[model samples]
Target chain A: MVVYGVALLAACYLIGVIAGDALGALIGVQANVGGVGIAMLLLLLVSNSTSIKLQLGEATASGITFWSAMYIPIVIAMAAKQNVVAAVSSGWMAVVAGTLAVLVSFALIPVLSRLGRGAPKV
Target chain B: MALDTLFDSLVELLARNGLITAFLFVGLVLALSNWLSKVVTRGQVHGSAVAIAAGLVLAYFGGVATGGSKGLADVGLFAGVGLLGGAMFRDFAIVATAYGADLGALRQAGWVGALSVVIGVVLSFVVGAAVAVAFGFTDPIAVTTIGAGAATYIVGPVTGTALGASSDVVALSVAAGLTKSILVMIGTPLVAKRIGLDNAHSALIYGGLMGTTSGVAAGLAATDPKLVPYGAMTATFYTGVGCLLGPSVLYFLVAAIL
Candidate 1:
């Protein structure tokens, strides 16, 4: 049944990739565009908005869940490994951005912690 | 002669083409990192962090050894890494993520929860873009891609791929996200007491503040297992919000600024 879901994903990607190309051309970016993201959104809308009764099996349900959870990590790890080699030479800009982002976010912890009500404001 | 050379021939084939070899290499790296985490840091540092660091070191050597465009790809045996790490698989993984999420919790998070996701995405993106500018990356694409990355690992690549940003920029985005994730995982427990991270409401806020889903989940697990569900609930929104704003509002904002 995971295949059932993948069938849906494939359709979304096909639409998404084409839309990405068209959007890229319009914007003049000439890239992969938001095909990946678009597909995700399309899938999200379909899954969330409608309650399709697939009556999936336990194994299939697990399979789909596994893919959903592990998707980003597996793909990013693979992509990052190949790209890290090139990124090193792209200069330290990427490194700098990453380090600075972490630092800034860390700094905001105290302020952000104050946002929600916590333990009677004590 | 045939019998003697059989093993040599097999090894040669494996080394010559990297498709399967790349999978092996990834697996081996993961195993090594898990081992390091267990024995060295005693799990204080996650295996994921260890693997990323090790991969970077290997990539540097691969670049030095080969002087090629792709680090490990320079080695004939590791060529499979290229195909394994390509966009096709990345997109596939991304598209599949939507299936598992339950959006019912968003309503439960109410207004504060929603606000947190939005603020988290914007703050992270702004910080990433600022650093990109400081580093002289004037191009909007690079800035937006990196900014998206700062939002979350998933958002970074999706944004990078969408904007036609270079692979290096995408890689940087991933690095930024990974660092944030590792920090969140380690820091959450230490700061739990001070921040009053003791309830579902606090966990939700924490998740929104730290948008990395895996990081939030792991950190909450360490701090308080009961908080995991709450934190994860909002962290999902962080990814959703990041993905939504990354290529649209954030990209345009970066473009206008630079």
Candidate 2:
């Protein structure tokens, strides 16, 4: 199962990257199929965990949605790169942006949750 | 001129082996994502219709990685096909609770962990996009690094839910934050130099870099066990310092290059 999962991940990545470009070209926006897949996987694992139990279907759907939304950062990052077109064409910038987005979001979670609590009364 | 050449070279390389490059890039991204999810789901792990969707991504990248291209029809077919992993790992707590497992009371804790991953992704992406837009450029790569730093440093422990050592997790987050700073300090300057940006202009690249790292550090320190609120105050302080250091060095390097 583990090996299968790993294989599946690898395969998905390749398709996401290659097809993303062709798709991106047609749409006039850089496509990050790999980014979306990873995001989906992340959500998939999170949702499935006996620990979270967000419900399989809901978690799966949300996972995709959240990951797709996460792509915004990659778009922004490429735009910020020295050559946006080349960056998108190469897709390295997207990889870097997507990785960083995941990391930053993961880190801030605790702090945000704490802050989400109403301030303690004096 | 040098930047242009490098960019041109990258473009050429990509164009020549677009399929291969795409596969490599996607493979790494998914692999990294898997590792990260392990940290979150602890091996618990995607979609239906979504299933074919994932398979299409798989088939396309796989074909490209293997030195070929999938047909448009195949790609479309794969996108619609979906897979279901049977069991949902996230609901472990609830399942246990129903069975009256000793840990049944901890379901909310599990939910916390799940929420951390979901919310973390959303917040960082939005913030990152805003930051990029403010800079008048949107490079997905930069936003990713900053967002990951934020997620790892800030959200890691909150998402931990006692599945593991919070202290250890916090320490790991610290390591990650430091890594972010170092990567930026080094990466920005190299990129700046490559692009022929004058030394004076490099600072702009480093600004958000620091903000991200510090945010994570603060989250880590704030959640650690050793520091009472007062001690954590110190952690918070350190986080600020770390945050400040990342961009500061980036700016200095940019300035030097320009």
Candidate 3:
């Protein structure tokens, strides 16, 4: 049953990759565009759709949940493998650019929050 | 001599099955990180963040110890780390995170939440690109990659890879993203009350504007556990939006300017 989840994921990933490649071609770029993100959106749609959910059953649904929780560990592995020393040594640009982005983004929060105040509560 | 032979064989066996070894090794790291988060930081920092920081440190030390470029994977026993952390698994894991999101809940956040996601991605990209230019990075590819990194760590590398930017630039983008994640994680609780981040509505906007799911989720957990899902929901969409725009539209915009 868990394997079914992986199968579904694989299907989504392949389709996403193809779609991304096509999109890239359409836009005149030579690489995949948003394949992972597209795959995620597809998964979200399939997982939420009543028809698909009914076919997937409870066991397969749990398989999806199992992989979802795996995100944290996988991300940790990804982070651990990055060459931080090299990145830091290359220049101060990375640090400066990142810090400024966060600071500016943080500053904009209040302004965005205020803009949303006019909308009625959902 | 017999014991030494057995130890050699064991190491070789593990090395041959590298993926399994990586799983075991990362499991230990995760366990340790979770413990540290719970016992040492009192959950002030999420376990994943701590694990990532630890992984970075270990990678630095691994590179130093081995005098190699591949980091820990250069060591005989940890070779599987390379494959486990490769782009294939990374993308797979990222895509899997969307499994449990509720569509109805997304609609509840309304149009403002949607606007925030777009604003968050573009704002971060513009600021990041500006800084990249300020630092004399005239290459549009590099500038776009770095700007994408400002959107989120995931977006940065994705953009960089798509644009065929140099590895060094990609690494820089990732570092930039990690910097933002840590800042958002630590800064959220402190700024919560001041920014009126007390309810689902504000949390959704906060998630969108921040756009780092881990940071926003952990920050919201610290602020209010109930708000985590709402913040994380929009933040997830933020990554999607960033990825879609970074390589295509955003890259063209930067290329036009430069």
Candidate 4:
């Protein structure tokens, strides 16, 4: 069963490559759309657990990472498609956004936690 | 007659360049995402980081080799695809187990998995948006960036889920680690040019959006909703600070290297 699943995943990867090539041509960017498809296939594989009742905590974390990652390009492409933004420029914007993210995360994470501690129970 | 002709030509251009081709790509990618999640995870362990890592790394290399440029969007897309594929593996196993007439445990695992992601995205989006406004940022890009970061802080489990599928977990984590660096290296500049947000305000707005999404993801993964609101707030605030400080720091680092 496991082998079959892996084989199925590989097949999907091949299809993804084909799709990515097509998408890449459409976007005219030096990027591969197929990789995204393949990666999604891999995510679905890891998140599943059988009767073993795999730890909920672990699985959820894994899911979040994959889902967010998946959306990045889609968002970029969507933004590009809408003409809200272009694909090439997104890189720099992401840097500014990322830097802001790190600093803000560091500063506010603790303060927020403390405030929550003092706040009335909901 | 010329004006009418020009208008018709423009409409055709828009239809050809923007709509049909782009959506076809989106559909292909989305369908691929769904299927990838299902196929790769047919029968794999749920919580093993190593297993997840193996799958992600393979995907990453595959992506890089195929595409030639491992830029911001590529990494983000890859990480998302990796995580989904990994998670789907776990989900399917449980469903398969239930197939043999065992439905008891499926409820908690499946529901929890779905709930965590759904709530994380929806709630984080709301909180991030509100905070972005509170911070006096009106740009949509900034808003989305903040929301995405905020989603990171909701729970550790969710964070793990995010990382589990990505080949470079640190790179994808909260958009602050290696992942953000790559993105900033590529995504930040591109977006800045496209939107004409070349000033400090652009920096702040962009930072806020990115930070919010990262924070929300972590908060949700940690399994603490109380942190969600706080995560959004901190993300917004710190993003502002980063906006103010990033340029100077970046310059100094660059200068020293040069």
Model 4 iRMS (Å) reads 15.7
Residue B135 error, candidate 4, Å:
35
Rank by lDDT, highest first.
Answer: 3, 1, 4, 2
Off by over 4 Å in 1: A16-35, A45-51, A69-98, A106-122, B1-12, B15-17, B106-258
User: What is the DockQ of the complex in model 3?
Assistant: 0.44
Provide the lDDT at B61 for model 2: 52
- The sequence of per-residue lDDT tens digits that candidate 1 reaches over residues B181-208 is 6556556666677777777666666777
Q: Model 3: residues >4 Å from true position, as ranges? A: A109-122, B1-5, B66-70, B108-118, B129-258
DockQ of each: 0.28, 0.06, 0.44, 0.04
lDDT tens readout by residue for model 3, B1-258: 999999999999999999899889889998998899899999977676576677767777877788776667777888888778766775676566567755564565668888988999999999889989998999999999999998888899889998999988898888778677756755777678788888767777888888876567446644665565467656756776788799989999999999
How well does each candidate superpose onto the true structure, as a TM-score?
0.58, 0.23, 0.73, 0.26
- Put the candidates in TM-score order, highest first: 3, 1, 4, 2
Give one digit per residue, the lDDT tens place, for model 3 in A1-122. 87898889889878987887777677654446556556767887898888888889777767666766665565555555655555455467777877787778778777777777765656
lDDT of 2 by residue, B1-258 (tens): 999999888766655664444334434444554565466546433111111222234434534444333212122222111111111211111111111112221222333333333443445434533443344434333333333333334332322222232353233333343334323322332343333322111111112223332222222121221111111111212222222322333223323533
**Per-residue alpha-carbon lDDT of model 4 for B1-258, expressed as tens digits?**
999999888656644454344344445654554455457655231112112222234434544445533321243323333222332332222122111221222222232222222332334334533454455645443443443443332221133332232322222223322333233323332343343333222222332334433322222212222222222221323322222222233223323533
lDDT of 4 by residue, A1-122 (tens): 33443443344444545565566557443334323323333334444554222533444444343433333223323222111112123343333433543344333323332332354443
True contacts kept of each: 0.37, 0.04, 0.55, 0.02
Clash counts for the predictions, in order: 1, 76, 0, 118
DockQ measured for candidate 4 = 0.04
Write the residue-wise lDDT of candidate 1 on A1-122 in tens digits.
Answer: 66765666678778877886776566654343445546655665676654553555565555546555544334324433443444445456655655565456555555555654442332
